[model samples]
Target: MSGSSKVKDGVSGLEFKISQISKNPPSLLVTLKNNNPSLPFTILKWNTPLDPQATNLGLFKLVDEETGKEIPMDGLKVNRLIPPSKEDLVTVAPGTEEAHEIVMNKPWLPEKRPASYNVTVSGKFSGVWEKYGDDLQASDLEAYLDSPFSGKSFTSNEVSMRVE
Candidate 1:
């Protein structure tokens, strides 16, 4: 969560949390009220990354597993980051064989809902720009999840999100 705490099997060990979810199905259903009024239809929730204390590349959305020609929510937003829990993640959330080499997750989204999920990694900018910038296409789910870019790596770089 903080810095790349430990390098394992050629990749950084990491975990991520749900930054925000853009829509709420029940609210977005457009209910007919007594006054015939519409109200807010979205909600946001927070999480303590599955693993509490694994340190890795701060937080970088490792190209989502769901692939397609979908556009990213916020390009100019630089990058979304999360705060490190300071607890040891290894014991809380054990590492896997496959993920031992790759540092990403595929969150299973609910069905029949129009929602956008933004995962806040543990770090700030610099890396997202240096890695996913230039090629705006890299921000694309499909492109970022494809070959080459999918295997992209950076030097021992670290960035912190200065919450102002």
Candidate 2:
């Protein structure tokens, strides 16, 4: 499935695209593209372009079509500490994109039998203004995001995939 997210009045944007990239061990290619003409999209380091968590949670989800249940992800760990550095942040320049490979396996499914599933992408769009100042404060940024026209969270269109 594919979809694009736009900020208030299209100040900036993000595009999500997914496709099957592997066959043996089924996998999905998740691509996130920056749609802003000049401003760069910032994301947490080691995470997908649309990951909203300050910590890395792996940016993907699978849902069973029959029972409408989410597949429980095992061995997922949450990082409690956040380091400050340029490397801690990933910038997607205008017209650029980042891709992630997600392997599809039975362990991630609610049931062992093969079935149809829907994929969804979700995350937050960090404010670009935060990058301008050296001494950034969360309180100040929070106030700005609290504005009436803020565009912070986004969810992509559901794309269907069948596994045997």
Candidate 3:
């Protein structure tokens, strides 16, 4: 499934897509495309679901279509005391896309398989740096934080899959 969202300011937009890579163990490939022609888009890697360390089970919502119940995710939640650093940011260059693969195993998925399931990516992109500290000051970083894409919540199109 694919979903796209245009920022309110029309300065940037993002296209998100999800495709099933495997069925037996259940894996998914997520792709993100930057629509801006001149500027690169930045996303908080710690909050983005595309990163496995970002808590994939919590960021991606999974529901059983037959039972109409949301599947519970068992995972650890990490809380950082300090603000996000430059390393925590992912940049998608102008008119470019990036992809990542997620393997859903025991903790993310129950031992028993559901007949059918619907999955959607949902999360908020947020983080601000009051002090650049040792990090390099760039115009692109300032532009991204000032843009409408910052601190925005997004939900992708729901994709349904059948489990045998």
Candidate 4:
């Protein structure tokens, strides 16, 4: 390791906040054409790339933009990786970009109300360790990750309008 590499092992964590919502973003747009409220909206997340050997991590949180309430993890119906069985893997190199798409399942929310969502980084290492998968087998480790690493607060977006 001679030259300065912008890529660091700790870089695999998400320091920035994550919020996915369009201001006046067409929350109520429908795929039916001339329809009200979109049937199913999705949440997309890009975490710092990391190896797949890390501990239990990865899951974007959902919050009510207005109520400041933390939505249940169940509502987050999608994931990037489901470890222990082998799967989720990304590198935390300079340009490494890991992503996750979570579908919003708040059917109880009014079809035309304002809401917001914020992403939560659930690990100390940004879960971006490039050697996570390999590390899974290794006994020696050198890092500390607190539970519930990072979280962005509720933002503001709207649901589709009622189709009359």
Candidate 5:
């Protein structure tokens, strides 16, 4: 399944695609496109699926199609610093896109087979910089956090798949 979100909150698009769902472990491709014409779109890497452990399954939501019940996800809950470092952010150039791949394994899939599931991701595009000060001036983390994308929640288009 493949889907994309419309422009919202200065974000161009959030594209989601599942390749070979029938496979034991499907590949989930998520791309974030920058709408800014000049400035590069910078956001916390922990906000994306790329850092599932940090997000603690907060990035993706999976529901059983038949039962209409939400599938539970488990991940490591990371304790981060007040001001994130430069390496903790992802920068998408203006008019460009950044893509990340996630392998859907047992943690993301239902135990029972031959079932269908719908998946969607929802979270803030960036961290809440307003609550944080420029404590780490050397990292220049405050600059990236203090953006229009900060603290803006977005939900991606839902994609469905059948597992045999």
Candidate 6:
């Protein structure tokens, strides 16, 4: 996965892969793996914007490869730009991986969509900075705590899946 910036932490070292979990419900499994040894990295949960961990959880879009048209995704809400309240960190140990399975239901991907479509996820992983200022409280620090000092932006390779 390529990022917007260059980071040395394991965040940039994450490897992404997508698979077709099921064709009946139209689901996809997205996995993030930490390829760096001796360096532990955290990824943001489903919400919270602009932080290191948060950067890794991105949005998914479907593209019709046959017609070159973009499919409208419904039921998928946009990310809220709320202030960081709690720290939802997923730590991946060296050579470990985490998977998120997405079920494409109505609005998100209608039950009757085209057969040839490619799924792409837009986002990146980030490395944490070593220094933390005293003025920042724990919650405040949560926003910048694992802030991306250097990292890469990620755009997943399109994985083709079809509806049964």
Pick the TM-score winner: 3
Model 3 per-residue lDDT tens digits across residues 50-87: 65474443787788888899988755677743445577
Error of 5 at 123 (Å): 0.7
Better of 1 and 3 by lDDT: 3
Better of 3 and 5 by lDDT: 3
Candidate 4, 66-155: lDDT as tens digits: 566765533222353322222433322233323332233334433544544433333223222223344433221212122122222222
Q: Against the unseen true structure, what C-alpha lDDT does each candidate score? A: 0.23, 0.54, 0.63, 0.28, 0.59, 0.55
Q: Candidate 4, which segments miss by more than 4 Å at Cα?
A: 1-17, 21-63, 69-85, 106-112, 117-164
TM-score per prediction, in order, is 0.17, 0.62, 0.73, 0.33, 0.72, 0.66
Kindly provide the TM-score of model 4 when superposed on the true structure, using C-alpha atoms.
0.33
lDDT of 2 by residue, 1-164 (tens): 35444343423466667776665466677676777677655554333433333113544567888879887654356553433344444456778887766666545454444677787756544344423233445553445444232355555556777776
Error of 5 at 54 (Å): 6.3
| Clash count per candidate | 5, 0, 0, 15, 0, 12
How many residue pairs of model 2 clash at the backbone? 0
What is the C-alpha local distance difference test score of candidate 5?
0.59
Kindly report which residue pairs in candidate 1 clash with one another.
Answer: 53-87, 53-89, 59-122, 59-123, 82-121
lDDT tens digits, residue span 1-164, model 5: 45566456534433323333344555566666665566554567776655645236557787989989998776556677766676676656666777776666655566787777787776665652221232335445655566545666666677776666
lDDT of 4: 0.28
All candidates: CA RMSD (Å):
20.8, 5.5, 4.8, 14.1, 4.9, 6.3
RMSD of 3: 4.8
Runs in model 5 lying further than 4 Å from the true structure: 1-3, 7-22, 52-55, 74-76, 128-147
Q: Which stretch of 10 consecutive residues in model 5 shows the poorest summed lDDT?
A: 127-136
Candidate 2 wrong stretches, greater than 4 Å = 5-11, 46-59, 72-77, 111-113, 125-151
